[model samples]
Target: MSEAVLRLSGLEKSYNRGKPNEVRVLRGVELALVPGEIVALVAPSGAGKSTLLHMAGLLDVPDAGTVEIGGREMGGLGDRARTAVRRREVGFVYQFHHLLPEFTALENITLPQLADGATERAAQARARELLSRVGLEARADHRPAALSGGEQQRVAFCRALANGPRILLADEPTGNLDPATADRLFDVLMELVADEGLSALIATHNLELAARMSRVLRLDGGALHPQA
Candidate 1:
């Protein structure tokens, strides 16, 4: 069934408060991502794409509006509840691969599972499976410092999928890589998303990447609208 896994309505956020320097970043944003969807969000710089992404990932709360994940509204959830929801439902990827330097590739992928109290064996198995999918099984024991930029990003992808997150939010995940590398990374990302039946909302500046998604939505004047 087509159901909204991640949804936002009437979202708004502003920096500074009741002062001459105050500026509204997002003005009444609304969007949704269904299960198995790969949607692209495009916007010019300073159009509040990052801010909206932060709010959707549950890293920050909007000054107004509500964000719901897996049918649970986060508007009234307390900090403890929000953290739990974030850990259980949302996965995030940034432009820079944020793999822990000290952790082996396997360990990095399994860290979130460990945090959620999964047994070592179970987490290892999951990590191994993901590494195989990302074609990084041989790098399992290597540290981030020992891997190339593309390899590091592959590990990051594995880590993000460790918990079987319902929604994966990728903010310019390939923005740091060269064209060929970025293309390969996106291929791996889309493969995993399909294989796991995971939903995704990726914010990007690359029109070619955006065009390949199921739908492309442009954020303009504080709102999201489908782009041709």
Candidate 2:
């Protein structure tokens, strides 16, 4: 097996711990994603898919477990340190495109670099290269409003890759698109994972998409389960 780029061991998360209305969102969940592997996290609604993704992506903390990326455990890290780790090692994609309305596609894609203190010029160059890689070179200067849903999503995919994150946590990346568009966008996503050698854990309800990944894991009953 490959060395893991991301690992979750004995992971647990809960809301309102030890009080009335306490609910465990994830329990004893264990998963690992190695470099260049794309795995699917599938489950029905209310099965804690998003909650688990949040913890895995470092957006939320686990109540009683550990999340490790690049060999660093996040269980005891402070908020600032965790944010830095996420910025350097993880990229996240949401269902919504979430592109900045005020910026062009290239600018929106490069925004993360500025947050990390990179020069605008350097970021722009990387962003444009990504745009080209996604076949969006001509759309670089267009605003999100001028793009189709699929185009906007393609830009978002490029944006997620902007920082060269070791792992990506994508939540329903193609959920909002039409079936045809969804398949196209999913292809772009998988191609990038293969071509760039990045690992990914993508949460989805699409079984066909899940089947296309290196492995398919179903999140059920607040735990990670491998599908046969």
User: Highest lDDT among the candidates is held by which one?
Assistant: 1
Which stretches of candidate 2 lie above 4 Å from their native place?
none
Please provide, for model 2 over 123-221, each residue's C-alpha lDDT reduced to its tens digit, 9 standing for 90 to 100.
999999989988999999999999999999999998888898889889999999999999999999998888878999999989999999999998877
What is the C-alpha local distance difference test score of each model?
Answer: 0.91, 0.90
* Top TM-score prediction, candidate number: 1
After the best TM-score superposition of candidate 1, give how far the Cα of residue 39 lies from its true spot, in angstroms.
0.5
Candidate 1 lDDT tens digits, 31-57: 988988999999998898889999998
- lDDT at residue 50 of model 1 (Cα atoms): 89
Q: What root-mean-square deviation over C-alphas does model 1 reach?
A: 0.9
How does candidate 2 score on lDDT? 0.90
